[model samples]
Target: MGKCSIKEAYVRIENGQVYVCNMNITPYEKGNIFNKDPLRPKRLLLHKSEINKLAAQTAQQGYTVVPLQVYLNGSLIKMEIGLARGKKLYDKRQDIAKKDQRREAEKEFKVRNLY
Candidate 1:
């Protein structure tokens, strides 16, 4: 219902568990009966082995876990998360240039196939 993005979200790791913080989930407009707080922390359901691995990786290296997508699978809601490292300005520029080059190559291939 409102604006929510990665800029407003972050992850918190504590007590051998992972908690997603600062994420907003807006409720329905028609009725406010079953609505909860929008900015509540949502605990992620991960295995013990996975949690330990994530904890170790973050401790030794400067990596952060970020949620990539939230979607429904069957009747359950699933979340996809990824480990991310901050990129410098130069790194970002290089990535952007590479992406543009790949896009151009794909476009050229499509045109060639059409003819």
Candidate 2:
């Protein structure tokens, strides 16, 4: 059983404090169900300045801050935060096509087995 990083983090503004809610850890993504806690609120690590910036962005309507990945970087757990607006349908389709093309190119690459 493997451990799960954060699946998702939704930022919320409550009483002038930046709060992250709805942290879900799924076994499907984590590889197995070991000490699974689905509805736990994990504390996010961010500097005061970064938190303030995220808080400000979230305060504005239609702006959001989301955690995309959580990984152990050099003995410390770090979360990659993104301040992003919602993407449209066309944008998502373009992203999918780009990914498919990249995968296809990689698949066509030849590698010599020198064993």
Report the number of the highest-TM-score candidate: 1
Tens digit per residue, CA lDDT, model 2, 1-115 = 2355445567665544555577665546635647556666666655678777778777776788777776777878666768879878899999999999998777666333332
Global CA lDDT of candidate 2, please? 0.68
Worst 10 residues of 1 by lDDT: 1-10
RMSD of each: 5.9, 7.2
Report how far off residue 75 is in candidate 1 (Å): 1.5
lDDT of 2 at 67: 74
lDDT of 1: 0.82
**Candidate 1 TM-score, C-alpha based:** 0.67
- Point to the candidate with the largest lDDT: 1
Report the lDDT of model 2 for residue 110. Answer: 38
Candidate 1 clashing pairs, residues 3+ apart or interchain: none
